[model samples]
Target chain A: MTASVTSLVNQPYKYGFVTDIESDTIPAGLSEDVIRLISAKKNEPDFMLEFRLKAYRQWLKMDEPTWAEVGYAKIDYQKIVYYSAPKQQKKLNSLDEVDPTLLETFEKLGIPLSEQKRLSNVAVDAIFDSVSVATTFREQLFEVGVIFCSISEAMREYPELIQKYLGSVVPVGDNFFAALNAAVFTDGSFVYIPKGVACPMELSTYFRINNGDSGQFERTLIVAEEGSSVSYLEGCTAPMFDTNQLHAAVVELVALDHADIKYSTVQNWYAGDANGKGGIYNFVTKRGLCQGVNSKISWTQVETGSAITWKYPSCVLVGDNSVGEFYSVALTNNMQQADTGTKMVHVGKNTRSTIISKGISAGKSENSYRGLVKIGPKADGARNYSQCDSMLIGDTAGANTFPYIQVQNNTARVEHEASTSKIGEDQLFFFRQRGISAEDAISMMISGFCKDVFSQLPMEFAVEADRLLALKLEGSVG
Target chain B: MISENSPIILSVNNLTANVNGTQILKGMNLEIKAGEIHAIMGPNGSGKSTFSKVLAGHPAYDVTGGEVQFLGQNLLELEPEDRARSGVFLAFQYPLEIPGVSNLDFLRVAYNSRQKHQGLEELDAFDFDELVQQKLDIVKMDAAFLNRSVNEGFSGGEKKRNEILQMALLEPKLGILDETDSGLDIDALKIVADGVNQLSNPDNATLMITHYQRLLNYVVPDYVHVMANGRIIRSGTKDLALELEARGYDWVLDEAAAGVA
Candidate 1:
């Protein structure tokens, strides 16, 4: 079993093929001038440039956080290109106007960018390297008053909405990674569901980083207004590189009175080789604010890649009788390390939150779930329930759970449960005795272990996540 | 009921095995023909369970020196899953609890594996549901058990019954019940015994590794063997079980020791 798991963990990254296209890349470095250059290249307004400048100044003073349970060498910011975009002849007016090589790259990544070839119900905003390549279903979304486009495009077209809500949920200098992302972020999806309007279709964004030396810093903002609801999906992948790439993304979400926002992510960045030579350093900050009475926000994520992952998608329940939920499945294999969970803060009366996290570690990997649940003094009758489960495939892998709960109100209730289990020989033997192969048995067990979290994902995303897990853990057992 | 020309289903000779460097099966020998029900009764640590596991090709047990044949194929050379696909089933004494994997899906996978092995048409989900529902009747299990995770929260008797349900689904040529009667109540034992009896036929065989003679009253074995120190010390008809029950295994051990001396 160990041999098979070793072999499986050594499986090459499937999405590691780099697209050979002419790119307009800035020199590798971080300075005030670099930030200004990025903003100027985007033709941004003065306010946007000021936002980047302030964030860049704040980032320079903040120190890199080492509290996460992941180990990696210090990253040299001076060696990473902050901006890299594919060279294009002109601004795309239609899918045909887009570079065919770029479109083919998306096709190879299993994301059909063309309208006729795309999934009908899903509106996709494809972001490659440092720019939004194409966005489908714009007309349909516009008719419903649902503004879904790239953040860079939103800055130029809907600056009022961007200015009002941008950094409102996650302000500049919120954290080290968020600060850096705010300064250098080139493009990400922007979603706005109008008041009393429930979006008719699921909105999705696919992010890809093709340049090896460039860092991807995309900022996503989603807002669901009063009595409105929307479900947004995000997916990411990066090419394999011998040098670790930096990805510091920031996502903010806001839900108003009686509104609901469900954000799901399927991140499949290229993890380093078996020996941990190179991979993506994914440090992300995501937060949602339940801003009005009876509002709700939920975050569901399936993280299966990245050499080092440090993320916690959190929710702040500030509205009366609001609700927050976080469901996540983080799998680490072959020298990968992940420290991920969620935080729920209850500041309103009768607010409630639920957290379910499943972590699977195989092939000398380390996985940890770190979560916090805090109930404020005014959060009377607040409630929280959390369950963190970990599964280790081999003897050398590791799993840890650190759950912090604080309740300042006497009427608040908090409950947490944690369990650690190993995929022992007995379990595999039982499956084999029933004529099931070792790989199939392991996959079945893993799927079972993560079913609770997977159930919270969108239908198509759930299916895709399941297949990705199977592919990731292929031949992972004897 | 064995016919005159009954074919041999399983044959073991000098089956020596070990687990964690400790020799468990010194030189066990056993044989079973189609249409026969054989029971091996032994004391604890007598390697009765180890013998059954070795036959199923469990990875933990190292076959130091042995030869096993099942349906004219070299069983020892096959992987555990291949051994299972080749019509050999070992009903575990403690069935594993696989949380979140529906029993229905588990059964379908096992059933289809055997079907694919035998070159039979695999059943789809709809057809499999129909087929598994019919087989569930053999053990008198509730249909609700099919949707729950495989034995995740089942009672002792329910887990044993679920094992039988799996057996009924796979329809193996040689079924080895490893202490399946243990932890079962009188009623559960009767239900389980009845299920086994119903599944038994002229073209297949049953091998029951047990410690009690009480189970034999319901599913009568044609032959009973007394095992000690990893090898069968005496072989006889069903009366041997009653005698051993009345006189205890010490008598058989002393008699065998005296004979060997």
Candidate 2:
């Protein structure tokens, strides 16, 4: 890890270089050997390796997706480094002996971490780059029969639970990205909120991309048993560099009878230079399953940074009377290209889903809204409603909407509405004559457009999302 | 510089404008002098609103010919913002709502923009608030409106009142009310007219563009120019507005085309 971070300061990024770390890298290609090597290095049992090898072979047969509303050169699989771990850093038994740099990094990212004098019962696992650095409050959580750790750690510690629920929601051959992630995924989060237990506090992941070229492939599995509920927040950022970095992560969520899960993300990856030279190509797949009766799942995201982003955090309403929701505000500035929305699939009776998406495109950026709502034959009395709107700041920018609805049941009802508009100069003059500058005028217009989605976030996060939109669109007024 | 007969604070000569190759205003000419309020009355497509938009430097309309002289300099030469800074306020027929920018913040920017252009010190938030509070009373606008987004979700009457409130804050040399009385009710119209009445003076002129004489009945105009086919065909006093109101527009259309020929 030290040499990779150091040598990165000098080497040209596009020209891939293999830095010396205790990396469990195979011959820089995806095949049966690579998957087996990866599973073996993690000390996984033979069954897991077979699953990975199957996923790897399936990924090879599948073509890299070209359907995303973004542009990039073809990815060379032989060039990507699959795995790396920290050298000689001991996994501490107590909080006092944890690596201070890891703690300091989380603190700089503004993780509120202090032992509450009385109620410090929340457990936290700080995952930095490709490794899980520290897991806090484990002893207390264990006393309550709770299990929370990294996915690799979960395989070693609680194999039975992992075996039962691992591939149930999103199997090994879910999609091109998911299959690739299943084969090469390094480290992510594993959380199991036990039956009838409500998590005392929010579980958070502050993800950062430090090493260049090496993509961070994280897989998060969140399971809420019957009558359980949990809320999780994921925040991502990266060090500023002048090359396009890649981050492909997959997240799966499951909620059983009467369980509820709320997931929110603030993705602020490095969004390239002003001339669109370098940034992060962030492609992520996040989905939740309402697995049993009366389960509820919701996704809220504020995406402000990325060179090219293709993501949809979605939900499948599989259980009877379950509810699904998606609230999002995706802002693209400069030369950024963001194509994001959500999908809600209704397969059970009396299911409900709601989606509200607001997109802002400025400069030469292109922002799109693509979503799907499907109601199966048995999903009688299913109801779905969606509202998507786009606000373009400059004339050169673009906004497009593609909503796919598949309803096979007459008893199911689905409604969708979308509109695209430019913030006319007349609006700015109207504002200027009132005493606002051009920039503030645009900022206010965008925030108002996004208020419906922003209000869904927590107070601090809502304010942060609003400010990020302003900062991302500074001077984008043509 | 404006004489009594031609209190022409704004003079346009052989003006022509087109939107996307379709001519809207062709060789139109009109003038408004200091202190006097002139009403431009015409049919829907007779360039009444286009005149206001062209004067305010809307980029979509191509100013194909002629010039607009305001005070002394060319009005078309200035950017819309600079025209605004130079005290030319156009009360749009459809006022745009800019959400998130508070009415107070917008007013301060407009206030300080003109002050800064005139080489005067800008007013801070507190002092500016005090100043705007007094002016809001003149428009009968609620003090709470200051915290809301400019013109956002405002009633039609409130939007007109807000436009006048901005005019009051900027104190422009030339104030053009482009169909300000269109959506106003009888009571709202009276309040708006009264707001305009209080702000008028010998040095600052007003040009009200209207489709009906009912608005002129309240905010009585000193001159009434009948616009026909993009040109001002006739000019007279308050009685002219009454005659046009009585005669309907068909006579003007016939007589003005004959007069032009």
Which one is best on lDDT? 1
- The pairs that clash in candidate 2 are A272-A278, A434-B106, A434-B107, A435-B106, A435-B109, A435-B110, B7-B33, B8-B33, B9-B32, B9-B33
Local accuracy of candidate 1 as per-residue lDDT tens digits, A1-28: 4465556545567899999999999999
Candidate 2: C-alpha RMSD to true structure equals 7.6
Model 1, residue A158: displacement in angstroms? 2.2
C-alpha displacement of B24 in model 1, angstroms?
3.2
Tens-place lDDT per residue, model 2, A1-478, is 1121112111122212222334333444556776676777778866677767777888877887788788877777777667655553455666556555555556666563435321244356666657776666666666765667788888778788777877677777888888888777877888898999987776766676766656778888899999998887778877767777778889999999999998888888888866788788888888899989999999999988878999988889999999999999888876889999999999999999999998887767889899999999999999999999888775667888989999999999899888675676667667654444566666667777888888888665788788777666553333
lDDT of 2 at A359: 87
Cα TM-score per model:
0.94, 0.77
lDDT of 2 at A252: 90
